[model samples]
Target: MGKSRHEKRAAIREHKEARRDRCESDAYLDANSRVIKAERNIPWWRR
Candidate 1:
């Protein structure tokens, strides 16, 4: 069966929260600013 609209939105919200937490925890600790900036410059579609 297909999920209801509310369920879909809740799943998306949960995923976003998890991603935000992960990004916050990393916070440039794993890589330097130059590498991160280069990554950011790339188009999302290419990535």
Candidate 2:
């Protein structure tokens, strides 16, 4: 049997929420890596 309209809507909402969460995590990781790289570049005397 085919899914009802409400069921289809719920599935789409769930998929969107999942995608948003993944994007947020990826952005966080990218920002964190940049910070770490910058810290590594700094010399001990300056830090």
Candidate 3:
């Protein structure tokens, strides 16, 4: 049998949610890497 309307909507919602979650994690990792790079660049006098 074909999927009901509710099932189709639910699948679409799940796909969107997964995409959003991946984007958020990627942003977090990018920010963290930048911070680490900045920390490594600090001069000994400033630490």
Question: For this target, which candidate reaches the highest TM-score against the unseen true structure?
Answer: 2
What digit string (tens of lDDT, one per residue) describes model 3 on residues 1-27?
999999999999999999888877977
Query: Candidate 2 — which residues are off by over 4 angstroms?
Result: 26-47
Candidate 1 vs candidate 2: the TM-score winner is 2
lDDT of each: 0.85, 0.93, 0.92
lDDT of 2 at 31: 99
lDDT of 1 by residue, 1-47 (tens): 99999999999999999988887666555566768788899999988
Better of 1 and 3 by lDDT: 3
lDDT value for candidate 2?
0.93
Residue pairs with clashing backbones, model 3: none
TM-scores of all predicted structures: 0.52, 0.55, 0.53
Regions of candidate 1 where Cα sits further than 4 Å from its true position = 26-47
- Whole-model lDDT, model 1: 0.85
Greater TM-score among 2 and 3 belongs to 2
User: How high is the lDDT of residue 45 in model 3?
Assistant: 92
lDDT by residue (tens digit), candidate 2, 1-47: 99999999999999999988887787788998999999999999998
